[model samples]
Target chain A: TAGITQAPTSQILAAGRSMTLRCTQDMRHNAMYWYRQDLGLGLRLIHYSNTAGTTGKGEVPDGYSVSRANTDDFPLTLASAVPSQTSVYFCASSVLLAGEQFFGPGTRLTVL
Target chain B: SQQGEEDPQALSIQEGENATMNCSYKTSINNLQWYRQNSGRGLVHLILIRSNEREKHSGRLRVTLDTSKKSSSLLITASRAADTASYFCATDQYSGGGADGLTFGKGTHLIIQP
Candidate 1:
């Protein structure tokens, strides 16, 4: 199995530009999450989906939007990228709600 | 914020030394988990300790939880250079919180100097 895969391993985006970060999991996990990691700040939840077709706001969901249309993919969209949004993004999946989460390699986005 | 907080923002130790990282959270939790992230890599699950349990171990890794104190500690014994990485402690809140997502801490950067 591929586990979880995130697209665009690295990117440089200009301010106010829009982009989508793709995440896919072959584990058929019922839950998927998007997190951004900043230096010394830890990982902050951007958004999460319990299952396909539904999404929920996380700790820092202001500049991001997520949609879970199917079980295999959940993508995060940045409508207007800001320099503050420059961080490493990670996608994770878990079969059991309370089980260990499997993470993707991560996408490093630099918003200039 | 219900984010977990870890002590000793950074640590540097010689090989074979034991490295301990402590995490403290505000709310009640059903389980606490430890994860390690090597530089430029995704996180790997290390161990999980349930609230009802006080201590758990796996190989050279030992974890302890004190619900009353709302804190947990992860100890890596006989550390090696390969063990140099950032360690984070996450908690699955006792409130059921609806989504079952873990709130992570700032993480402790551990370096095992050879």
Candidate 2:
């Protein structure tokens, strides 16, 4: 089992461009999350899904959007990327909310 | 702002020694988790302790939680160079279904010298 897989291992996009970070998990977990890891800031949640078809905003959700159409995938979209949005993005899945999670390798994005 | 704050932003220790990292958070939580991230990699779940539990052990890892003080500590016995990485503490402020996912601390950078 792949556990969790993320696409676009790394990317360099221009400001105001649009991009989507893909996240898929074979664990069939009920909860999935999107987080951005930045220098000195740790990892901040951007969005989360309690289960398939339900999504919620997180601490730093202003510049990002997420959709959970199914249990295996939760993708985060940045409509207009900013320099500040350039950071390592991680996708995680847990059997239940607030439980131990399994995380993907991560997507490194650089916006210039 | 981050809810959890890990003490000693950075720590360097020699092999065979024990490395201890502390994390303190604000507010009540159902459980607290500790994760280790190697360079350019995703965070790996090391251990988790519930609010009611005082201490937990896993292999060479030991974790202690003090709900009254809202603090937790992670201890790695007989540290090796492979233990060199950034350690982060995460907590779910509310159990079950809280919109705000897990809150992570800035992390304690642990460097184990050979």
Candidate 3:
């Protein structure tokens, strides 16, 4: 089974342009998350969804938004991309809130 | 803010040697987990230890957690080049029995020389 899959393995965008990173899990998980990994900042949570139709802001959620319309999919959107948003974004899913999360391959975004 | 910090930002050792990494967290946690990431790839869950458990072992990897000190250590015995990767410790902070996301450390970069 494809535990989780992310679209556009990599992308390059101009500043001020909008983009949406797609994440889908076949594990039928109840919890999904979006995280951005920087060089030395580690992985910071952008947003999370406990279940379908419920989304919550995380530690670093200022410039990002997420929607969990269903259990298998959670997408992160950047209304207007900025150079600071250039980082590796990861999508993960877990069976429960505190369970071991399975991550997708990851999507590398570059904002110029 | 990050909940945990890993000691020795980077480590290098020859194959057949044992490597150890340490992690310290700030707040109380329900569980702690270790994840490994190869270059340009996503992280893979290695192991998880609950607050109540002190030590756990799986294959060549051994993990020890000390709730009293809010610290943990991971040991890789007979390491190989294939084990070379960045290891991160994540903490599932206790939120009074509510949903909470795991906070991760910067991670330790391990290099195994052949």
Candidate 4:
């Protein structure tokens, strides 16, 4: 069912350029999240959405924004990229807020 | 900033042996989940243990949660080469912080040698 899918498996962008990482889940999960994994630091939450229309900031949400316009898609946008934003980005979703999550393959972003 | 921290950043063992990984969190959690990530792949959920629960099992995976210790362990018995991957522990917290996303540890890279 393609539990979850992320676009642009990897991207190399120049600092100050903008990009959007797309996430879509077919499981019809009620909650979706965006996280970035850095070496030695693990995965840090950047943003989350409890439902299609409601969103909230997470542990590391600066320089990024998200929009959940519908039930299937939760897209994260980098208005202006920075070198510190380079990391492996993951998109996850769960049917229940506190249940196990399904993750996408991930997008490797390198901002230079 | 991560709530959970996994021990033994890397582990190597022979196939058919047992491998165990530990995770400790700084805050109370509603549930703790174990996930495995193969090289260049997305994470796959292995099991989940709720706070009130002491242990859980699925296939060859056994997970034990000690809420009092704020720690959890994942044990994989009779490990196989296919079991070589990075194991991560994630926690969904207890506080009512809206949209409190799951916090993950740095992960334990387990290698099963043949």
Candidate 5:
């Protein structure tokens, strides 16, 4: 079913460049999330969508933005990427409140 | 900032040995989940224990939760090299429409030596 899929598996971007990490789920889940994992640090939420057309800020949302235009897709955008943004990003989806979450393969971004 | 904290940052054990990892959280939660991540890959959901439940098991894995103590433990029986991975605990709080997603712990790097 391709539970969840993320695009641009890996990318190398120059500082100040812009890029979007794409995430899609076919499970018709109502909740989707964006998280970044850094060395020594656990995954931190970047943004989340309760449902289509609604998004909320998470713990680390300063350099990132997200949009949930439909039930199947939630994309994260990085404007003017920085070296600090170099990390593996993951997207997840869940069926209901507090349900088990399924994660995508992840996108590795390296900013030089 | 990690909501859940896993103790013993890392662990190494031989095959057939039992491995245990602990996790502690600060606040109440609707449920807590365990995930395993292999090197350079996405996390795979292992198991989930609800606040109302105290213990759960899946195959060779057993999980125990003590709400009063605000802590949980994951035990793997008869470990194998394929079980080598980093294990993390994530909590899903009732607040925030369950949309807050999971607050993950630093994780325990488990190496099951063959």
Candidate 6:
């Protein structure tokens, strides 16, 4: 079973361009999250969805936005990408709020 | 800012030896989880221990939680080359309502030499 899957394994975009990172989960989880991993900084949450149609801002939500239109998809968008936004983005899903999360392979985005 | 901080930023150990990493957090949490990530890859959940739980084990992984001290430790026994990766400790901060995201530590880079 494809527990979680992310699209566009890697991408390079010019600053000021818009991009969307796709994340999907087949586990039928109730909660989904988007995070960015950087060197020495660990993983920082960008956005999260408690359930379909509901989203919340996370620790680093300034440059990113997320939409949870359906139960299986949670896509993160960078309306105007910046060099600082270059990082490995991960999407995770959990059966419950405090339960263990399962992460996707990740999408590496480079803003130049 | 991160809620948890992992000690020994890096560790190198020979195969068959044991490796232990510690994590300290600043706030109350509903649970703490451990995850492993290979270079340039996504994280894989290893284990989770709740606030009231003291210790948990999964195969070669042993996790201990000390809520009083707001700290946790992950121990890997008989480490192998495949165990080389970055380990992170994430905390599910306790909240009154709504869903909460996890706060992660800087992580420990473990290198298991064969």
Over B1-114, each residue of candidate 5 has an lDDT whose tens digit, in order, gives: 678999879999999999999999999888899999999899999999999999999999999999999999999999999999999999975454444778899999999989
Residue pairs in candidate 5 whose N, alpha carbon or C atoms collide under 3 angstroms: none
TM-score of chain B of each: 0.94, 0.94, 0.96, 0.96, 0.95, 0.96
Chain A, model 3: TM = 0.98
Query: 2 or 6, which is superior by DockQ?
Result: 6
lDDT of 6 by residue, B1-114 (tens): 799999989999999999999999999888999999999888999999999999999999999999999999999999999999999999986555755779899999999999
Greater-DockQ candidate between 3 and 4: 3
Clashes per prediction?
1, 0, 0, 0, 0, 0
Top DockQ model: 3
lDDT of 4 by residue, B1-114 (tens): 788999889999999999999999988788899999998888889998988999999999999999999999999999999999999999986455653768889999999999
Model 6 over residues A1-112: C-alpha lDDT tens digits?
Answer: 9889999999999999999999999999999999999888999988988899999888899989899999999999999999999999999999987589999999999999
Regarding lDDT, does 2 or 3 come out ahead? 3
Chain B TM for prediction 5: 0.95
Pick the TM-score winner.
3
Candidate 5 regions exceeding 4 Å error are: B94-99
Q: Which should have the higher lDDT, number 1 or number 2? A: 2
Write candidate 5's Cα lDDT for A41-106 as tens digits.
989988988889998887899999999889999999998999999999999998864578899999
lDDT of each: 0.91, 0.93, 0.94, 0.92, 0.92, 0.93
TM-score of 3: 0.98
After aligning candidate 2 to the native by TM-score, how far in Å is the CA of B71 from where it should be? Answer: 0.5
Model 4 interface DockQ: 0.77
Give per-residue CA lDDT, model 3, range A2-85, as digits (tens): 889999899999999999999999998999999999999999988988889988877899889999999999999999999999
Cα displacement (angstroms), candidate 5, residue B61, comes to 0.8
Clashing pairs in 1: B29-B94
Candidates in order, TM-scores: namely 0.96, 0.97, 0.98, 0.97, 0.97, 0.97
